[model samples]
Target: MKRNPMDFMPAYFTVAFVWFTTHFGGGFASGRQLVEFFVQYGWYALFTPVIAIAINALVFYYAWDFSVAHQKFQYRSWTDAFYKPYERVFSNLYDVVFNLVLVVATAVAFATGGATLADVLGTPYLLNTLVIAIIMFILTIYGANIVRAAASWIAVIVITGLLFIYGSNLVVTLPNLMTVLNEAPAPRGFWYALWQSIKYAGLQAALLGGYVAVTDVLKNKQDVKRAAICGFILNAGIMVLASAVVLSYYPTIISEAVPVVFIIRNGFGGVALELLVSLLIFLGVISTGVNLIYGGSKRIVSVWAKPEEGEKSIKNKRIIASGIYVFITWSIALMGLIPLVAIGYSYVAYLALPIVVIPVLYKGITKRGGEKGKSNELDAMTAADGPKA
Candidate 1:
């Protein structure tokens, strides 16, 4: 039976949800990054979500268009599309920056996962990091299909569990919600607040490009758009819910590095809550790790492995590349190099800002204009694919 593209649209939504949730892991969920950008500014911190959503919408819009036009469903990383236009200076810059960032991000995730495991299960951080890396490596080596299956199941459980936890906190802290909002100090000024919001949102969207690459495989532009919008809504809702949960215990959250864990401990003291939170955290890290490894491996394999030419098998090459990455990331993490790597990669992302912003603008405007005005190559490709020219 031939599968209709429309039938896969719902899958895109799931893909988007998993993508956003995974990207939102390290800093956004921790509240550390949010605090650095918004909370310090006070009441104005509320605007951060708005800014983040707008940027996310724009990025996803282009990502969907690029995927549909190309008709190539295996774009496991945005750099593939990004390299299409600015192949000379910008593409090279993007490639370098993305790999560098992935290395650091993977390391950070490993470290964080270890720390979370230690906190929740009394396991050593070093051992936990190795365990996660090994599991993630094996999963990536198998391929995206396997990763997607795991992510789909885990996302359902994590989202449902988080909703329950946040909902309970909201009800219990109803009175304090408004007080926290009103009494919080306003940012130093409107401009400072706005810039902080922009930077925070921009960085997140930029990094999320790697995750959005998977959507390229979806055959329908409409599906891509719908999925992106749905994903954006879900992400915003979760962020708001998370913020509310943390704010309920503002004092405790303000000092704690892992606010989500703290919220669980304070709001639900039983072993059940601890176990649930631990599982959610573990799944969150695993989903993100798998996505990162898959993205990195795909990029390397596509460039170096010439399976069509019979030089190497793409699948086997991908497995080898993924293993190498996992080993390197784990080794760096074991050496306690996560912090320095994270900071360096952040700087590299700043450098790659131009590469991301330009193509995103081009894709959005051209795609929004309709197929007639699209580039000649894209129009011909779409026509060949029978998308109604």
Candidate 2:
């Protein structure tokens, strides 16, 4: 099963795009999260992405290495790898809380997509919601390969669109950028702001398991290494650019519901702005929703399937699970976007602090007591068997 890293080039790109799209959707693209988590910190906010990149990189690297070593592609196995005596407790907690967050977050994405399409096409919200739900459900049933491919390429298009929007806005704002930076206030100190930034990144806990679970596709440490680097750059690069644009218009657009849309309308205006903004929101919502559903189903099906189950049987279970998952998410999507994102996202960020950040980072850094040997065993297995786990 192990092959040349060159042979897995597509997987590398798929993982990178999946990681980017997973975090880059809904709250993130809406510029709502950017305003609250990044721009609100004033001049120090510039450093927020730096801290986030570091934390994301550290956590991602550990997850990738650990997953590959143990041949653990599911979230439960991942928890078992590190939690051990407390694996049952932590795994159960993570499975419940992480899925809850993902379902709500995916619903937020679905709701946003529906609203954006309805706004653009003058269609009814219900019709838009039904269509979006159907499309997402179809994508989920196709499972990981199709989802990853769609998300990866769609992410490229979205990011390119973002660069156009943010890049143009930044060019215009650069004239007044110095004044904005000087006048921006730090409501909290730099250290506190930095802590908030790290917490914001940790809110991504729901996506972490799936992100690392892609190790099932990878063939070598070099592939995982390159994938991590590419993923971090794609994600961090966008965050920095988007944060700077938000900061450029800080204080003024801070209170807007979707600050980035406001900036785009002001700069681009008319049909062009509408097309761009609609595309951004619609694509962002679908990409995140698909990744979340795909990820959760992967983990859930892994939990349900017997160890000796054949690939076809496991896939059949995924189809059933994905259908049920999509229905629940669609129901939640009816709650709408603003309330789901504004209220729900921040609390999840705080919860992730202890549940995901501390335990994973501690184990990854310390390598723990017996984990080194476990890692070696994994390396030996990989060496002998050629990455079939």
Candidate 3:
């Protein structure tokens, strides 16, 4: 039965936070993404983020609803159904995109951890990366459920810290922000700025696999609508807010390897807040990397290894998979946070825009959003009627 968006608010927000937390990791925590993707555009930063985010809302709504309607919860199956006729090509392409997302995401998380700590401790960046990798390797070995629960709580804490840090700093930096808006030239121009914004959305599109994977939580089309609306508001809203905060500092803090740490250390807050933000970012790094690493490990084990039907076999492959992926990401992180976000991430966005974002947006607009419009849809217990799919 169709219900109001207001109904099932808890479940809707639960789904919404998944997208928000997924987006709000190392790239976001450091604020480099905002600077590289938006703030660099000068005044254009004001609206471009919203544009990219609007696309994310639409794409996620269609992808998730289509997944629920068709009962293609796993990404591979969904790709087969959604990309039919062209599935032979697009399906394999999307596998490349999703796996690349995991690599970039895990690497960024590691780099964020390394850079954040190295900024404070005067430690070696690669060593810091290894330390973070080792910690995650040990934790993920325990199981997924523990880290999943920890990630939820860390999301709440990170949100609170963001508000406390940025909210206060914005008021103090209002004059600086206004001056930059009036004086700084938007060197990239309007069209180029818009392309960057689109690419930013494309980089985020890589997460559709993770986002759509959870749509089984939506009982009906109403829940899907609510989740999409809430997802856009929270995810886009936070990015815009971060843009505003980072914009206030403008060209000076923009070049910093870690903008959040720069802001806190310079004057935004005292030593205590700096350490606090660092701790939160570290927690986010650990949780995000652990979860993503496990996903990669699981995929490797399930697909190629196809371990014998036993926990022992599966666990052993998982350990090996985790180690290999971590080593790959650790090498990537050595490039430093700025190069990884600006250079490495931009390449992924360019790749994802064509295969992942554009196709998903096309399907979302052209296809029937859900099975609700079908006359021969299934009854309860099937996906159409939505009894837990």
Candidate 4:
């Protein structure tokens, strides 16, 4: 029996959710990235996400090419194909950049958690972040897969909570948003907005590792295409709405460490919704931080620990590596969430542009978007053939 096209809709959505969840981590979930990249730029922020969408989707479409076509799912092997003959240098280079990405992303996660905790608990910012850091260290040193397994569902739940909160806020404050747009300053910030969007797109491109790492579920170019298109819609649409929510309050929203949290506490939603979302943000960032830290620790174990040495030695390296990252991220998180989003992510963008974005764009354009010109296994497989007992 031929499978209905809709029969595989869920699978395609799962892939799209992978991209969304990776992108929607601590920084995004906190609503800080929206403020930094779009809301701060004034009314033009309304349209900046479109520019960002183009840049991001362009990178995503081509970045997935080498991985999907060649069945390179692991980050290292995937990079081997993306950079091709020069994988020797560029792959090693990307490895460094990705580790740094892990660091910044985790640090941002801690910072986000701290901010959310402080808002809910009225604790000291430093103390909250430190506590969050310690918890992530303990959690990450133990395991990773369970959290990775939950990320997709986390995306769904957190996104639902955000949509309701932001959407309701939009409804309540629609007039405010409209007033801001109409009275939006005459300067019409253009170049600055686009530059921020570019920076944001480049910074996000750093996570191409996380995104492509899961493309194993995608069958072929068509699967990749639908997933990418779905990604663009989900990422951009939600971002635009979030930015509008922030813009409704304008410069006041600027002061918030976690704008969405601020909105909730300011009486946008009922107490129950606030608590649930708060818990979600707290768990969400911790999970995100732990997953990334554990990934980095495994990398260290692979490099410094020879499996033949003993299981204890390997486990020790893993623990030690987690501690090192925990300390570094603790220090970075001290700079607070805004600095992490504005400064830390900006640096990541600078690193990502040449290493991830430019190379892929070059490869994509020169190779005609990496068309295989023949049927591949991924494209030929039926839905039922993907998994075997």
> Using lDDT as the measure, which candidate wins?
3
The worst-scoring run of ten residues by lDDT in candidate 4 lies at 376-385
Ranking by lDDT: 3, 2, 4, 1
lDDT of 1 by residue, 119-232 (tens): 888999889988888888887766544655666677678779878877777787767768877667554777777766666555555554356435544557777777778777
In model 3, what are the clashing residue pairs, if there are any? none
Q: In order, how many clashes per candidate?
A: 1, 0, 0, 0
Q: Which of candidates 1 and 4 reaches a greater lDDT?
A: 4
lDDT of 2 at 276: 84
Error of 2 at 69 (Å): 1.0
lDDT of 3 by residue, 1-389 (tens): 22212343355665676677777878888888888999978878888999998888888888888777776645665677778778899988888887888788878999998888888778887788888899888866654333344445666777788888888888877787899888965987999999999998998887777665445556767888998998888777777777887888878877787888877776578888888888878877876677666655655654544324456566677788888988898777767678778887788898889888788888787873433322111111111111221
Q: Distance from true position, residue 60, model 4, in Å?
A: 2.1
Comparing 3 and 4 by TM-score, which wins? 3
Residues 1-389 of candidate 2 have per-residue lDDT tens digits of 43323344466667778788878777787787777777877877666876877687777777777777666666666777667779888888777767877887787777777776776678888887788777877877665556667776688789888888888888877756678777767888788888878877778754676575445666566767777788888888888888887787768887776777677766645578777878878778788877777667767676577646665676677778778877898888888777777678777777776888777789878886235323322222212112332
List per-prediction Cα lDDT, in the order shown: 0.62, 0.72, 0.74, 0.72
| 10 residues in a row with least lDDT, candidate 3 | 375-384
Residue-by-residue lDDT tens digits, candidate 4, 314-357: 66777899899888987887777787777778888888889988
Residue 57, model 3: lDDT of 88
Error of 3 at 350 (Å): 1.1
The lDDT of model 2 is 0.72
For candidate 3, what is the lDDT?
0.74
Superposed Cα deviation of residue 276, candidate 4 (Å): 3.1
